[model samples]
Target: MKDLIKESISDLKKSDGFVYVTAEGEKIDLHEAAAKGIAVTPVNPKSEVIKKLEAAGLDLTDSKFLNDLNELISLLSGSGSTKGKSGKRRTFSDSEKSKIVEEWKKVEAAGKKTKAAFAREIGVGYQTFINWLRD
Candidate 1:
């Protein structure tokens, strides 16, 4: 089972995600790296531990579950409310915003109605198109 845990950790790291680990004593910490998100689930922490994780609410499904959770946590961490450390909201400069608007106008001249529609016509997501417009 130790090998299985290690293999799972390897897989998670490769996928830029995390896994549970109890190898180093009883300590469990959420480790995040640019390569991936990782959660070391302590070995034999207790059956109730799993229940607690579930009760606290988590997907726990296979695939990118660990990655998704870690990513969400990281995102929240930057948003300030996660730890009561507020940060400035993102804002685009006028020139950049103007560029986006100009590009949108050009696309509009070619007969685009909405950002999503324009994005579809140009092979991108609606949000991407909006971002381009707001450059």
Candidate 2:
């Protein structure tokens, strides 16, 4: 039975849509079936996944079930407590900063009040530009 369940799950993962039939012959949509599958898992999930599951008809009143479903979804999505963080913070050289500041000055002299547009022109956030001005 476990093997059959695993096989069904694998099939569901591979297919874009799956139709599930209940004992009483009620047809469940792909989203609802996915939600039911998620609900039976042993881990807690993220809020987004929980929202989707709730939309698919899972009762959020059962906290244990909701938590498990969320965890399962997070694991399946390759995220959550198990995933490692990556990527380094971007840094600008002094010369690069000077060049950006000069461009910002030119924009200011042109009487442009759109800080966002000036920031985009120099490839930085408006807040970052404001911080650069302070520096």
Candidate 3:
């Protein structure tokens, strides 16, 4: 998975606005969304997510949306508004996963922290963050 991200994502062969991820892996299907470089789900135009995104002056679509979602989720968790911090594992929606991936990229591009640092900052295990990126 890391190889795919490092290679396929780096290649970014865009065909008709869609990137073709050709990394070879048993679970990496070229037809799947990940293999096509669609790392995030698009929010409905009228959905609350879109509204919040617009209110926050963020793009209503694409990576920006995913990043904002992660930011919001992180803020909620830190503010004690979400119970996801409980010892039990919390299931994240597809959208949430997308958000996490975007946020991970954002932090990584900043070049100030390692993967472990990011996990600690987000109150999650290092492997968990890597798993999120893997998915």
Candidate 4:
């Protein structure tokens, strides 16, 4: 079982394909994989081997490898968490954030007159003004 787990991890490291096996074969738990910077997919949770691995030394509460594991799982299974296809959310860059803030300032200046009128003057939706204010 241990060998199978090792093999599965090794294979995942080398390939983009999923490691499919019988329910009784060695499996790595999604939590363990996540901790180890490996992504475990939904298919992994169903493998009895993964359950067994979870019974071993791996700790699910560990956060270090969760992201990598999730990414690996997504890469294999073609499904991902709500964050998107990468199994994680992509945040705006510093430059993008700064630009948004600058744009917001301009929008706010125009909004001082009236939301609807300012939106029309800027050729933007009224909701854009609201969104900028929230940001």
Candidate 5:
């Protein structure tokens, strides 16, 4: 199983088009983002935030209100935003990636459990780990 897993990881690393590319429209850092991967998407005009902004009729032309509205959204979005303190997504370094793979191996050797369980136990989202492994 370990050998198969190693081979699978190797194959995943070698055979990637895109994994973590789905994102709502925001162009601020798209230059940097493209190197990671480009996703096909529109600005999601029907999203909850958009609906609220439209219903409230807040003038988004005002920069001050944008920040205020953002804060309000964060407050409403509950606590699933555990990626970073400031609500930004987290990135892993090469050394961190190596450490995570080692830990994954150790866990796999310890017993038979689902990857989702391992992810929940370790506090890393399963999809996020899979995305990193692909990259």
Candidate 6:
């Protein structure tokens, strides 16, 4: 029975998508696995064997399960736009702002055309430059 179960688990790992079998021999799909909060891989963790193991009362807190769950959560949540404290809102000094504005005027006078192009050259967003002009 143990060997059979192990073989089933191995088969489950090899199969595609999230699969969970209820103790009563019912199959669970990806949507069901997600709804049940089962630890599944980020790239479709469903499998028939998984469903069977789950139905057989698989340990949800198993180390491998937790690790996979954490990885999936991280992948789903994204890496975030900000990078630590350095990405926090910044307060530009008056001199820096003036310098930027002056550079922007030179670009404008030089017929750089697109505001976005000039903004890119100066390493700032076009909207940011517009906001500076408004200030």
lDDT of the candidates, in the order given: 0.52, 0.60, 0.59, 0.54, 0.57, 0.62
Question: What are the TM-scores, per candidate, against the unseen true structure?
Answer: 0.26, 0.34, 0.35, 0.21, 0.32, 0.34
Q: Give the per-residue Cα lDDT of candidate 5 at 15.
A: 34
Better of 1 and 2 by TM-score: 2
Deviation in Å, model 2, residue 89 alpha carbon: 4.1
Instruction: Please rank every candidate by TM-score, starting with the best.
Output: 3, 6, 2, 5, 1, 4
Which wins on TM-score, candidate 3 or candidate 6?
A: 3
* Top candidate, metric lDDT: 6
Which segments of candidate 4 are over 4 A away from where they belong?
A: 1-8, 23-42, 45-52, 64-135
lDDT of 2 by residue, 22-124 (tens): 5554545546667777332222123333454456667677987877777688667744432232334457898988888887788789997577767754446
Model 6 TM: 0.34
lDDT of 1 by residue, 12-125 (tens): 454323334544533335453223554345344333344445555644554478766665776666521233323444455678657667877987788747677555443445
Comparing 3 with 6 on lDDT, the higher-scoring candidate is: 6
Using alpha carbons, what is the TM-score of model 2? 0.34
Error of 6 at 102 (Å): 0.8
Top-TM-score structure, candidate number: 3
Candidate 5 residue lDDT tens string, 12-105:
4543333232455343233466676765442332233334444556555688888776767755774233333563555778998778877877
lDDT of 1: 0.52
lDDT of 2 at 30: 47
Local accuracy of candidate 3 as per-residue lDDT tens digits, 22-127: 3341223335765567444332223433444456565657785676566687777763233345568666788987887799898889888788877777667788
With candidate 6 superimposed using the best TM-score fit, by how many Å does residue 79's alpha carbon deviate from the native? 19
User: Where does candidate 4 clash, by residue pair?
Assistant: 27-49, 34-65, 34-66, 38-69, 39-69
To one decimal, what is the Cα RMSD in angstroms of model 6 from the true structure? 13.1
